[model samples]
Target: MKVIRARSAGFCWGVERAIEIAREYATQGKRPVFTDGPLIHNSQMMERLEAEGIREVGDYLSQTSLEFGLTDAEKQRAVMVVRAHGISPERRGYLKQLGMKFRDATCPDVGSIAGRIKLHARKGYTTVIFGDPKHPEVIGLMGYTEGRGHVISTEKDIDFLPPLEDKICMVSQSTMFTFDFERLAQYLRQRYPGALVFNTICGATRERQSDVLVLAKQGAEAIVVIGGRHSANTVKLAALVEKQKLPCYHVETAAELDLEQLGQYKVIGVTAGASTPGFLIDEACEKLAST
Candidate 1:
């Protein structure tokens, strides 16, 4: 069996930046470093950071509680790092009100989407987000809409949108599937002729998905996608592989790889989500090579 790994697999620029910032703070040993949430979706990465003395605090929308067993004084004194996904403006304001010292590690691409929503909303345009509504990125985006935004995951959801007298501005989560976003954009164009659509899916996501497509076309009998189960981008890659009618397995780490099943394939493609760490991808590749 041969193992072919996607060149674009593993951490993207944003995730890399976030991790770098967290590590810098952790290394400085300053003020009990804490992230607003998991720095990234990968559990292994999170555990590694925890072992290094960096910890995750509060949810995106809520305040930091005694969840980390930190006393009020500790919570107040600790430096908070906002996760890559970003947080709602309301939450930012609330944090400010509490006088918490925090650093914003929001990805530039995601931050741009929020800025676009705010810009359009100020001009009386309703923002339409194409992605999972419950996602932290989308939630932060909705905060910029000034209550004039709607979240829809599909073209069908577009039908349920409230009637809009003004123009509509449509944007998508940075990690969403590009094809899905385009399909929905096409539908919105036909339904609302004046709707403005922005392809907010980041270039890294496009590259990762494109790499998987190339692997499928290259006749890989099976594909292994590595990433956290909760990672939206990683799940999409696995789904894309399955859509190509090839056997695909989504695993969080090498331990989850089904060696017995994968041994049957002559050629196996390996790819990972944007949030995946390089070491995890290396482990999967090593395991496959050994088998």
Candidate 2:
């Protein structure tokens, strides 16, 4: 069996920045701090953070040691973090209403698109967001404006879009495909002229797609996309591989790989999510090779 790892696999710029910020804060004695989410999609990273004094808080209203859990006393002492996935603007206001101290660790690229939405909206352009509606990133972006905005998973989702009397501003989640988002943007323009599109998909997403596409093109018998099942970006990469008709497995860990499946392929290409760690990739490689 031959195992080839995608050159552009694993942690992206945003994940790196978020983790670094958490570590920096922890080092400064910010013990019992609460993150809005796991900080990233990877369980290993979450466990590591828990060991370092950072507590995980999936929801602000949860019973965890977050701002929500903090009595009036702890709210004045402990910190509340907006994770990389970010919280909605409404959520931010609600947090404020709770009188919590928050440190926004949203990626700069993500923040830029949200800022631009405000700018373009001021210029009379309606905004269209490309992503799963349930995604935290999308939820956060949507909170940025109370104006007219539409969310779409495909161009067909916009087939019934209202006539553009003014203008259109289309943006995407940072983990979406550049090519797909552009194609969707072009479709919207064909249907509605005077529409503006911003490719908010991050540079890291493009690299991961490009690397996996190259692996698929090289005739790899099977591909393993490693990431959390809930991770939208990682799932998107897996979908990209599937378009090639190659056998692909989207697994969170090496333990998830089936030995029976390995028998069907000789060349296996491995790729991982932005939140995935290097060691997870290495473990998958070793397990896949051994099988």
Candidate 3:
């Protein structure tokens, strides 16, 4: 079998930065360190961090308290690390009110989108987010718009939007499908002629998606996508490959690969999500090569 791996597979700059920051904190041996959420979507990486004495806290106040598991006195000595997905401004303020210290690990690309929304919202514009409303990144971006933000997963959702006389500013989740975002942006502009649109999807995501499209077009018999099940970007990659009419398996680790299924393919392509570690990608590639 011929095994081909996507060059763009594995960690992007932002996830790498967040992991580096967390590791640095872990080595300091100072106060206990906790992330606002799993630093990234990969469960294996989260487990590795936990083994290194780093922990994750849930988003809700009650969940945070439970996950923290520290007394008031102990809590005062803890340092919280904001995840790469970032948190809402309101949540940041609430953390400050609790006298908690946190280090922001928000991706610069995600930060820029939030900044743009806040700037436009201050000028009385409504923010339209082309993303899943429940996504952590979108949740954080919405905070910048006060109460004037709306989320739409598809172009159809735009029809359900309340009529807005105010100017509109649109941005996308950093990991959204590039083509879908453009289509949605076009629809919004047709309806609101003066609406401002920003292509906030990260370059890494675009390149990864493009790479997979190319592989599928090249007639790879099957494609293997590696990442956590909860990873939205990984799910999108798998869906994109399937849309191309090629067999695709979305697996978290090499162990999940089906030897019998993969054996049927003479040439297979491999790719991974942004949050995936390089080692996991290598392992998957090696497994495919062996088969």
lDDT of 2 by residue, 194-268 (tens): 777788888888899899988877767889999988788889889988987888899988888897967688899
lDDT (CA) per prediction: 0.88, 0.81, 0.88
**Candidate 3, lDDT over the whole model:** 0.88
The local lDDT score (0 to 100) that residue 275 gets in candidate 1 is 96
TM-scores for all candidates: the values are: 0.94, 0.90, 0.94
> Model 3, range 1-291, lDDT digits (tens) per residue?
888888899999999999888888677666677888788999998998888878887874335463345678877877778888888998887666655567888999899999999999999999999998888998888899979999998878999999998499999999999889999999999999999999999998999999998787666899999999999999999999998889999999999999998899999999999999998999999988987
Q: Candidate 2: which pairs clash?
A: none
User: What are the RMSDs of all candidates, in order?
Assistant: 1.9, 2.5, 1.9
Model 1 is weakest, by summed lDDT over 10 consecutive residues, at 61-70
- Looking at candidate 3, what is the lDDT of residue 280? 95
* C-alpha root-mean-square deviation, candidate 2: 2.5
